[model samples]
Target: MATQTPREAPAQAGRRLDLSAPWWSSPRWQEEKRRIRGELAALEARITPRRRLRAVIRTLARHGLLRLMQDRRAAAPSAGDASHGRHPHRDPDRRLRQIGRRLRLAFQELGPAFIKLGQVLVTRQELLPDPITAELAQLLDRVPPMPFPYLAVVLDEELPDGLQTFAWIDPEPIGSASLAQVYRAQLRDGRRCAVKVIRPLVDKLFQTDIANIARLARRLQRLLPPAVAASSDLPGLIRDYYSSVQSELDMRIEARNTREGRELVEEFGTLAVPEVYLATRRVLVTEYVDGWNIKDFPVDFFTFEERFERMIDLAHLYIKEFLNGRYHADPHGSNLIVWRHSKKVYVIDWGMVGRMDALHTEAIFRHLLHIRLNQAEDAAEVMLDVFEPTPYTDVGRLKDQLRSLYIRYVDTEQAGPHNWGHLLVEEIRIAMDNHCRIPTGLSLWAKGWSAAEGTARWLCPEISYHTVVESADVQILRRLLARRFNYRANAAWIAEASELVATLPRRLNKILERAAWNDFKLPVEGRLSEQATRNLNRMVNRATLGLISGSFFLGSALLAALGGGALDRIPGLAAVTTTALWGSLGVGVYTVWRVLRSNKA
Candidate 1:
């Protein structure tokens, strides 16, 4: 047999069929499944059952399942795990202090992902153990230094041509993290700056890890107990993680972040975001702000209260900027460096920033105020609104539960002078327990505020955080409300709204085209029975009334016949009743017919 030239084929006359199937159900899904299964099988070969079990549990926990089980197991009497065993020492506030320390240690052991997780965890005083939460509150993940050889490669790539373009490249990294590491260096022109290089395999690792974690989370959510599932918004948390962490892997995204963050706080003058240096991928260069670590700064320079208040004021300013506009997402202590020369706040690491819609800005501020006023019911509604709770839950019950929870624990005195973050955390946990899904933006917002509050408290123990936050509310509310009524012509807002509208039509067109191609199949099975039941009930009611009316008419006719033979007192009553029953039957029949016709359509 002669083999034809490989490329030759008979041309089909008709257009090819495009099934336009779902990604999961499609043939491509099988390929992905095969690839993932192979990876898992390879992993299975390397690890023991115990280690694999731990990995699986962690994976499930990452996805959002087995958290409650883990919590329960941790609380149970351990066989021999001394590391996590209950502490013997019982000082009045030792536990609180220890929590922060334990969290810091946990992050260190968990590696970059867990350190970042702990960083996020500490921000959310509302979700975890308070002592641990407070402790993790202070934890910082400064990236460890990378090898000089790799640094040289990055410098060469960044400068292009050769390393001779730069005058001096620092041997030591100023900062490091899981995604990328940063080093302080001087440019060829003698400008002092920082160079950030993406960790070689960080992106690939994150992509794979995130995929596995997301899969695990979905599985856990489906398999986990209702209470655990209710308590944690695991999927949302993962999604938020994806948005923040994934962006960190992209230097270009970081560059954009630097630009946006700098622009946002430009008006503050006292705050700074580093100026981005235009260079190649996996390498970013920015002006280095000469600063003292805010935590390590001289405490003796000002009265304790003044220092605390100043920090509080700065925090308020940061929150105002974030809530009112696009936020510098990672406002943790590591990212928030205080510039020594100018005494200005410098925000570094803009990889994770979130934007605020007018609604989010309003709702968050409103929620804060409601908390202050002790309006638990109102606050719960705001919580629901902020979280965008599903309609399945009872709003009234949630509100009542919130009221009870708030009434039980929101102590004005015990809450301390400047620890609103702790209070916010409590509120969130209660909401979570009551089946509320915490909004990612709100969670991050809460986390940032709590951290700043803690920092401010540590710096200025006498400064009342409540007072600072309340003052911010007054300022923002006054301005925002006035703006609402006045309807100031904001060019930026107009431009954004215009852009949004312009994008909508294209998005809608794409969605409609896709839907049309996919046969526009709506999920009607669920609704069908409901519609039928309602129609059927209405139909039965009409039919019953019709039958009753017909019986009355017949009775009246017989009564009339009896009356014609001999006048009787009941005959007149029976005639009137029969006439009324006949009229009812006529109406019922019409009603049933109408219901049937509507159901058919």
Candidate 2:
């Protein structure tokens, strides 16, 4: 949070400390301080933010992305610049794809923290372009699995009985990701489950990378524009990510989240989380889900209706649970699997989730409902009210842009897909472009929504996520409105109203007394209207021109009349004086006409 210096402490600190004593001649306290300083110096040398930053740079440079990362503001290559077949260089799309590949590689090389960052960042389609986000979305936890022996070491250290508690663990892991590796196992009680053990040293690496991540975000932000306003806040995003990742770091939290998720989705029989058996910081045992991820689901064998229904359930899960305050953040294909032959949607991941309060829940609900009703201005207004404004923001322009996007995308006549996630993102993106800053919490939740819609798209390309959720959105909005108007919900408003009514007579008397004394004054605050402003400026400029022209005309006319003697002596002089008078008069008349025309306009 504060700046670092190369010195042991600071010059000011030395003024307040006993740093004057040499180590050998020092008193007990001074000797202790010197010893502590030496240890601190050694530790700093061994592990420092600078060292981690260098590793990041080296990895990026290896992937040929260091320059690209620094030059984030560079305009993307245009299609027109690229030649066709047998061209000397690649097209813009091709180049973008290449950059995405390189970025994915660099993130993988950066360690778990960066890989996780990339994974989460991809969900923010509003900020990142599609080609890049597509590649990053594919940046899975492809880290090589930690050996079973090493995992056993961790299990032995964390578990009371270790391997003995499990009837048996498959030596081969069923799932290996950046954070943990999962294996099929059985408890002594004959309960079959998946054992998820944190990979050795990953926790340490993630902690280190997370610290360096803040530094990296700071450096990258410097390489770009000022933080007037942005669709994405790099430092804030990193901090939010750190908090979310922190929860994942603890297995107990994940278990609690899973339990909570299961309870929320209990109404939908097909949608559920794998049962948690044993939970610990280093390990978690849960019922092993056997199903096909949406990506690999047998599309040919299943009907679109089945897929659509399952997706609806997922959407309801989010919409309903969001109001309740928690929903699975990452509902991507891998995280939620489809039953092998059935269309049951099983949510299996709970390490990360999104939450909302009454304000945000209502804001989001109303925004969506208003957009559905084609009340673009109201939706735009809702956003304007929720987000904090930044220096770059133009309120009028933001409203205009958001209104245009809403009308363009929400055409019921159009058969083309209208992605709800992209629509939401566009709202944020336009707001950001006009200096409307979205809070980090909202941004994080928006990404989760984006991922959910992306998965929905995969399942029902014919019926988009928006179409499926539209009806549900209406119901949710109705409930929201009901609650908003409920007596208990409006207690403060009712109290304020009652006070106003009770004091009405006294307040009116005061106003009447002031009016009787002729001392009442009304205050008005207004700005120059565009039309008025233009007319006022025009009048001032024309008046100035007319004044100068009129003076010239009068002077020329007088000079012409006064040049009688000179004219008799020199005929050319008389003619020149006449021309000057006529020209000045014409200019004066023209200036007057312009002023009149402007006033009429």
Candidate 3:
């Protein structure tokens, strides 16, 4: 009856007419679904080409900017170039000044990333030629400050209350760098602080630039000569560059570094680090330090004694941190300041710090010790242990070079301002030339030392880095010895003692047997005691007599045994035997008397 009215099926009620499985569960439908996913993935993969194209364009733009700046420099010839034509006899100082000025201008125009690159280049004399490195050293944190509106926005985002959190913030920044700018601010609590604000979009821009540079570096590595590529370590350098810049971008890391550094150097009493107030991914707030930056201070500001004392304190700070295995990686003049009132030196900007493991620290300590003792061979060995040698390295040649370095820089009879920093830099270069891989941290440490030395020399040219190192070594040794004796003997000492005790019996037995065989020899020096001399003489006489008596006895016994031979027929045989026996007896009695007399005495 329902079939008669087909429309009355009630639209198939609640269930479908065909009760098939879901499409996704069907094998054919699943295969089609996978094909769609594969198509989507292929489309996603196509986006990479667009991204690569964008990267290429950005790289080309950077190259164009560099080329434009270089062309401008070439167009504007120096006075020497204009006058001399083919071979200009230019004053070296003037030429360097011109180059430095041009380089600084170009870096400034190329923007923050290039400026940072230039700053890093200043510390890498091994990677760049001297002129280029010297020119790059002029690069400073003189970037144009971000507009107050944008900075306020950043502040608002970082601190929920925005600029209202501070009583007053200087619109004009005190210092401006590539990634961040520092402004003087007073908190609502009336605490003066330095506010460091990371520039907007710097992270994204740096990421893009660094990626392009890394890709370019890889390409260049393939094109470069084998020796040049090996020596440059382009990949490693790029990686380190990326890591350091990224770390700098994260202000929280710098804050942590600052706190750790403060704790590490707090024992010096004369050294201090600014107290951190707030730290975030892009912002850092620290106690406002009012002091003269070492770079800006006049040489005459401090008296000779004051400068010398400061030098000593500075040296101690660096040496202690180095020996402790954590050191400020960048101790340039701008990063250091001297408080006029307290005379305390404040180290600021703990962005780039270095760390050495215990083994590295111990190796460095040993190296310093060897240098102090003028043990070139030991120093060379320490260096070898620290550096990874390549197959092409000639260890003997490396040692000879190190010996020469020690003699020239460390072994001079007269104490002078020997730049240990420069010496270390040279050592790194030598190791590189020898195909030895010097730790990058060591290079950074050496750069810091060089910068410190330069700053010290600027303040007082007469200050001797070598003297500071020697004095530091003495202090370190004294402290080490004190610590060593402060505690009771450790398990190591106990173990050594136990070993000695265990072997004592064997050693004593060997000595006694040697003495019994008369094979023992005593090493003597200086003066001999009267009893000792007398005993030695008596023992010699007894030994002689004993030998003679033993020979006589043996001869007599042989003659007696051979009585049936020709000698038995001789009439004097009995007399000879009797004489030998009487002589032997007499000698034996005399020997015994001498022994008894010596014992009585």
Candidate 4:
């Protein structure tokens, strides 16, 4: 046989982008510049008149290379070449979705702030294309960290007299993103923690780039095609882009958010929060969690199914607890840590917590049940309320449109599997384009839940969406009900109730005096409308009644579910409980039915 030689496989692609060495010092910068220039040149011919103008401005603004780069068009492929023209579009909607995906991919390749922006965009699903939103939701901040030397410089500047002050510092970082890098280290007292240090001089350049992007967003808000513009949230959407960028620059906020999240999740068993250590302007130190990434947990440690189920269960619990009270807010895979010893989830990094009020949280459960039951109209109403449309807007018409949109989205996905996160985003985007704005809390809640849902589905295919939804709905609602009951009994409520009681005696005295004088004819109020007086009294009655009713029902339910031997009080109450299980099933069935009807035509 003839002698043959085998070619070696290429080195891991990641090895090419090592961050241990300073990025600017790497000769790779030249290669990247060349690559970008080449891409820009190729992109030039495909650009429309306006987009070409944008391209030119962007190119100049990015590199200050005013002179048109070498035009290799003469040597390049003609328009007939596959690389020279746009991809064939059999379906325009698909093409639009592809555009969104491509844009997100571009941001991913750009690294850090852009990747963070993409992460934020996915969370703001109501303001972006469904396909785009879905794709962006997959964004992970996996950029290489700055060289240790540069990081050392940052620490030195921020710490005043440094290194000698600390007992031990790891030269390598555990996790790195576009904005900040986290390293494992120990204090002089031998306490183990991770120090997250921001990049040096990243703010000025990043802010400038962001300001330019903001201006571009404004211009595009006015210029995109009707369908395209309608598909995006634009200006309002990018408002937080700047805020997030500014936030990443300060580590103090992260310290505070993490501390608060720890306290919030502390009450829950099987869930833990990382403890924050010393926090300075540029660095935040927190207890190092000895846990595995939920998704990447070793199969040897647990079966595939076990891994998946645990992740899903963790997500369900965390989300319920979060929406019920405060949330870790951002529950991306990176933030999820599976503690091996206790088999609990330790969520870290809480810079972007979302607040859900009573009304919004309740509406979310209603929406979830609606989805589980597939009741289209009820779902639509909840969507409208969540979006908070204007009175002048034709909700009926919008509902019809939303129903069609939902059908299209559901139909487009394989096997008719719908992602709630993407669906919510689409619904929100539609509302925003039509002058509706969903509360930030609701949007974040949707994002967090969608992430949990997606992770759960990925972990356990046998875990039915309906079951997950129902379980979460029950727990969240129960917790919220408890909180409401507690609030009604709070000192504030006591004071208000006392004042109302005190007023009752004076009002009674007036009534008695009037009756005694036989001048019982009540003076008609002229300033206030009868309708206003009636409404106010009705509200007061409802508040008082609601407090009493909710507390009683909640207590009864708790006693029935958990109080040992309490069920034996009534004659054949066990049999009644057995029968009542059927009633509960019927309610669930009806709830799902309502959701389907409301969500569809």
Best by lDDT: 2
Q: Clash pairs of candidate 1?
A: 63-217, 100-135, 123-447, 125-425, 126-425, 143-176, 143-177, 308-460, 549-581
Better of 2 and 4 by lDDT: 2
Of 1 and 2, the candidate ahead on lDDT is 2
Q: Which tens-of-lDDT digit does each residue in 120-239 have in candidate 2? A: 777666677778887887776456665555565567568887556776556667777778888777787878788888876666677788887787788887777544425446798788
Where does model 2 exceed 4 Å of error?
A: 1-50, 69-90, 219-232, 299-305, 340-343, 412-417, 460-464, 486-488, 491-601
Error of 4 at 424 (Å): 2.1
What lDDT score is found at residue 495 in candidate 4?
100
What lDDT score goes with residue 561 in model 1?
69
Candidate 1 lDDT over residue span 1-601, tens digit each: 0121101211211221111224323454445445544654575455443453465456544544334444334444445546442543433245445545644654454345555666666656666666566576454554354454444445554656445555555555667666667766666677877878876545544555566567677998888655457657677787888777767766888898788777777666556778986556778889898876667667664556546545655766666765566676556566667776766767788777766676666776776677667776776777667654543345676777666655543434323542456556666676666666765577666666666666665555665566666667667877578657654547667888999999999999988998989866656433234357777777687667667766766766666666654544445665565566567567657766775776742
In model 3, the runs with Cα more than 4 Å from the true position are: 1-86, 89-107, 228-232, 298-303, 411-418, 478-601
Q: Which ten residues in a row are the worst by lDDT in model 4?
A: 1-10
Query: RMSD to the native, candidate 3?
Result: 28.4
lDDT of 4 at 34: 52
TM-score of each: 0.61, 0.70, 0.64, 0.59
Off by over 4 Å in 1: 1-74, 77-139, 226-233, 302-313, 374-377, 388-397, 404-418, 482-601
| lDDT tens readout by residue for model 3, 447-541 | 87777777676656675666666777776776556545644546667889999999999999999999999999998645444467777877887
Better of 1 and 3 by TM-score: 3
Model 3 lDDT, residue 554, Cα: 77
